[model samples]
Target: MKVGVVDYDAGNLKSVQTALAYLGADQFVSADPEELLSADRLVFPGVGDASSAMRVLRSRGLDAVIREFVSRGDPVLGICLGSQIVLERSEEGNVDCLGIVPGASVRFPKERGLKVPHMGWNQVSYQAGHSLFRGIPQGTSFYFVHSYYTQPLRADLVLCESEYGEKFCCGLIAGNLAATQFHPEKSGEYGLKLLSNFLYWDPERNL
Candidate 1:
């Protein structure tokens, strides 16, 4: 499938591309609107400041395009900072996000006896089934490296949660939009399974 990685001047571009390629996805990477919109699946990933990332996306008018793409029922998988961008707003930025997933992004609590950028392996407690996490076993350990966390407004949409200072929403699925706090690209076999699920994802059957 033509899986296009949204090149929004964020981080982890090469890793994401490599992972998708390894999962047998004929992936494409582009920052152009036409190229991004034409793909079968869109990979909206990032690893940097949310405000700055939003600025870059807005400069190229990608913010609107992403909203349109997902609205049309195209699948979008956001990773790391990409995940946070799905929220309604973020404490890290003045610009509003795509709002595909109803939520706000906030800085992880360092005062709560946890690291800011939670970097390491963590087990997810999958709340329920979704196509993206289809073959991924519950309690599957995925690699995470991020500071901000999403607090989804519609809490019921959270499909999975993982612990750090507290149990935070790790996986979100709302309609055609799906996002994750961890880097599935770096999560080894567990990551591969998640990517594979997305490759052959059928939301209709999944529902």
Candidate 2:
């Protein structure tokens, strides 16, 4: 299957590209909406500021394209900032987002001397039966590098939880959409396994 990695000039495309290459998956990175819409699956990965990213997406008309792709029941994998902006809004720039899911992204509280950007490795607790977690042990650690956390309106959408200073929804799965606050491409072996699972995942059979 051909996988399209959205390149909105704000994502860390190279690393994601390398990971997909390692997996030997057919993939392409592009900013063209038509090319992206042609893929069987899509990976929305991003870094940097949320508002600026939103600006780029809007300028290129990627915002609507992504919504259309997901609406078609095509599989989508969102990473880091990609995950945050897919929600209804983000506190980072107080900007409204794609609203693919009902939620908002909020910055971490500075209480308890916790770091603003919750970097490094942290374990995520997820259902072992989920296709994305197949062949992966429970409580596997994933690499994270974000100051903001996503809060979906519906609690049932959360697929995985993790703690930095407090518990946060690190992953969410809804219909054909799946997203993660952590960078699976940067998380090592288990992370690679997650990507592989995503590549082969059948959204119709999703849990």
Candidate 3:
């Protein structure tokens, strides 16, 4: 199956591409709208500041293309900054986002002794039966590195939660769209399992 990674000029595309290659899936990385829209599935991964990322996507006319792609009912997985971008808005730069997932991205408070960026590995707890977490044991740890967290407005869409200073949504699933605030590509075996599930996930069947 054709799998495409949305380049948008702000993601760890190489790492994601490498993971897909390891999974033996046909994959390509691109910023071109037609290239991405033609893929069987898409991975919208990103890192770096929200406002600037949005600027890059807008400049490339990818913002509209992504929405159109999703409207067609294909699967799109977002990771880290990519996940946050799919939300309604982000407080990071007071920026508006894709709104595919109903939510807002908010910065972690500067509580004393608590680090701004919640980096490193953390366990995720999700209810069973979701394709993305299928066969993956509970409390599986995934790597994370970010100063902001997604607070999905539709709380039922949350697949898992992780704690830093407090609990926050770590994964989200809604029909053909799925996203995670952690970098599954950097999470080792657990990460690989998640990616594999995503590779074969059937949104319609799951529905």
RMSD of each: 1.3, 1.0, 1.2
TM-score of 3: 0.96
> Evaluated with lDDT, which candidate comes out highest?
2
How far residue 115's Cα lies from its native spot in candidate 3, in Å, is: 1.0
Q: Per-residue alpha-carbon lDDT of model 1 for 1-207, expressed as tens digits?
A: 699899989976999999888877889889999888889888898899999998899999898778987878878888888888888888996669877778799888778777678999999987566667876778889999988888898777786899986789987878777888888889999898888887777665773
Overlapping backbone residue pairs in candidate 3 total 0
Candidate lDDT values, in order: 0.84, 0.92, 0.88
Global Cα lDDT for candidate 3:
0.88
Off by over 4 Å in 1: none
Off by over 4 Å in 3: none
Q: Give per-residue CA lDDT, model 2, range 29-65, as digits (tens).
A: 9999999999999999999999999999999999987
Worst 10 residues of 1 by lDDT: 198-207
Q: Model 2: runs farther than 4 Å from truth? A: none
Write candidate 3's Cα lDDT for 1-207 as tens digits: 899898888856899999999999999999898888889999989999999999999999889777876789888898999889988999988999988889899998886468879999998998577778887888889999999999999878897899887888988777788899999999998899999999998889972
Instruction: Give the C-alpha miss distance for residue 156 in model 2, angstroms.
Output: 1.3
Model 1 C-alpha RMSD to native:
1.3
Error of 2 at 12 (Å): 1.9
